[model samples]
Target: MNPDNAATMVAIEIQQPGGPDALIPAERPVPSPGKGEVLVEVAAAGVNRPDVLQRRGFYPPPPGASDLPGLEVAGEVVAAGEGATHLIGERVCALVAGGGYAQYAVAPAGTCLPVPESLSMAEAAALPETVFTVWHNLFERGAAVEGEWALIHGGTSGIGTTAIALCRLFGVKAAVTCGSDDKCAAALAQGAAAAINYRTQDFVAEVQRLTGGRGVEVVLDMVGGDYLPRNVQCLAEDGRHVSIATQRGVTAELNIMDVMRRRLHLTGSTLRPRSTAFKTALAEEIRREVWPFVESGQLRPVMDRTFPLREAAAAHARMEAGDHVGKIVLTV
Candidate 1:
């Protein structure tokens, strides 16, 4: 690596909120790791829906975070702050608040997971954001256990595919919704118990049919708005509804009496704004529960495409196009 590149790195930044064109390349000073953090010379970064939202001006980085748009990265740790020296020279993948778009990004030591030799830099880069979100929302908050059934929306998306893969590994059955038949097929190929074409079919009715009218035990919803009430209809008695994103719209109207009558549970979470202590705890839990699958090569991200770091705009465009089947990544 060039010594000057260690001091200055090429990063993609949003010049102004609009479209993919808003993301522009620029030279930025390499960020230094703080106490309990490690500085990664990033090899690859994952592109997520949040990155697209940030580019469109809908989502903003949390306070004290880099304005650059990236959530997860995989690379080699070259420098470490206090209490993090042990991680130096280790290949790690991490979930970050922001700044993952740069060549060098600082990550909390606790959030960095060791990258096994079985996975490539691009594949490792794709794990953290989706894995953390699914583990927390599906298993932890939703209380989905083995042998239960889960309904996941956006089946071809990074989160949906991760959820499907985890459900398959953990013995939970997953039924996913997609916009097209091809996507539905893709979801089925990814180990989903069933796939619903939401664009042409009524998912609530389909879920009922698939479960023999008993409905699903859990619903992992990404499309909120009117989908909330519809999602509730797709759940069984004492079912859990976990919302992770509001892709459709935020506000929704629901029948409270119905919720009460069915003994239903509703919950949601956003990972970026959470405290470092909370994220660290989550990281540890995943390291224990899910890392084994990753290390053993039994689990891997379903990759869609990879773009050069300088062409982040093209990556954003691909995500927005909604034609991709899995994770979109940026390689440095």
Candidate 2:
């Protein structure tokens, strides 16, 4: 590798997983594109919950994935691997297995999506991970549809904001729960028909009241633990409850009778552990169904704030504080 080329790259690494302090900056060689890959000179990277978990040692990188923390990136493609066409020096955003926290990262050819002509690199970086999660959990598995009611927990989160925008674009009525009145208002502004402040309000009763006792058709829940039982109770007949994370805790006792009697469907998944083929299929679906909305400016990322790449620890701290209304980004 040329010394000048090698000198251009930087990365954040975990010396030992623990807390925000674990993210340490270091120099790295600019990676070369391998077969079926493209080398992106990252302009920005999205900060996600999984990055926090990874920094805490609670989540490990999947096989063949980068050991660094970032899961998504937006940048110009600087180099293309052999057999990779249709992309060269193109501004793109991609869902990567890892390596997004670096100044340079490699993305599989199939996973790269054209950055919307309307969005900045920072805004584009925020889309792939959150949009992929929302589409898969809410529409694909949860079977959410137009004119149906969808309830999202953590409504002020990156996932929540994206879900709200997507539901609105799809003509679905959306309700969400957040931590405060301010967060609730933010959620509502993002297209949530109703935003419940979980700290001061009862989400179940609110959902029932909002829907006139019918409840919502689908609940996208990230808060597990005792919320699980109440979540099932808040579901409409034949409703689906998809649990994506256990922020509150995983194990919970729930009434099987409710599930059987209501004919409900309960399902959930994590994206990191999934196969590349699965992600490729998802990327294609996003391109076909969701990309147009982004292109037309109907759906776009809600960026809370951005920090320089060297300030990754501060970014992680802000996310951990739960003060953000949307995605936090690291600009390279």
| CA lDDT of each prediction against the hidden true structure | 0.95, 0.91
TM per candidate = 0.98, 0.97
Top-TM-score candidate index = 1
lDDT of 1 by residue, 1-332 (tens): 22344678899989999999999999988898889999999999999999988888999999999999999999999888899999889999999999999899999998999999989999999999999999999999999999899999999999999999999999999999999999999999999999999989999999999899999999999999999999999999999999999988999999999999999999999999998999999999999999999999999999999999999989888898999999999999
TM-score of structure candidate 2: 0.97
Model 1 ranges with Cα > 4 A deviation: 1-5
* lDDT, candidate 2, 191-280, per-residue tens: 899999999999999999999999899999999999999998889999999989999998999899989999999999999888877898
How many residue pairs of model 2 clash at the backbone?
Answer: 0
Cα RMSD (Å) between model 2 and the true structure?
Answer: 1.4
Specify the poorest-scoring 10-residue window by lDDT in model 2: 1-10
Candidate 1: the clashing residue pairs are: none
